[model samples]
Target: MKAENLAKILKNYTSGWVSISKNYKKVIASGRTLRVLLQKLEKMGNPDGYLMRAAKDYSGYVGV
Candidate 1:
């Protein structure tokens, strides 16, 4: 997925970590931190095109 699209998906979550699928149609995982979310996703065995982002603020957009 394009970085722009990834950023757009991330915008939906105000805080915490988010895991998005390749098609950007589903959420694979979510958590309070990148490490926690990564560990959770890892258990599912490295998803392709999956993207992770840490949202630190709710007032504006943030990137991974």
Candidate 2:
């Protein structure tokens, strides 16, 4: 997916799991935990797409 599009879709999410469309053009679902997210997906007939995490604020996050 393009960085520009990804940033826009993820802007509202500070922390949680997000289900994005396969073409990366839309948000299918989101949840504070994986389990909740999966349950939501199941209810949606488990649409084909990608599962991702919207992490905590990274403005001050340090990673290796």
Highest-TM-score candidate: 2
Candidate 1 ranges beyond 4 A from true positions = 1-12, 54-64
Candidate 1, 21: how far from true, in Å? 0.6
TM accuracy, model 1: 0.58
Off by over 4 Å in 2: 1-4, 56-64
lDDT of 1: 0.67
> What would the per-residue lDDT of candidate 2 be over residues 1-64, giving only the tens digit for each residue?
2333466676788888989897777889999998999999999999998887786554543322
TM agreement with the true structure for every prediction: 0.58, 0.77
In order, candidate lDDTs are: 0.67, 0.78
Worst-scoring 10-residue span by lDDT in model 1: 1-10
> Candidate 1: which pairs clash?
none
Tens-digit per-residue lDDT, 1-64, candidate 1: 3544444556567667777776777677887888888888889897865555556443464444
lDDT of 2: 0.78
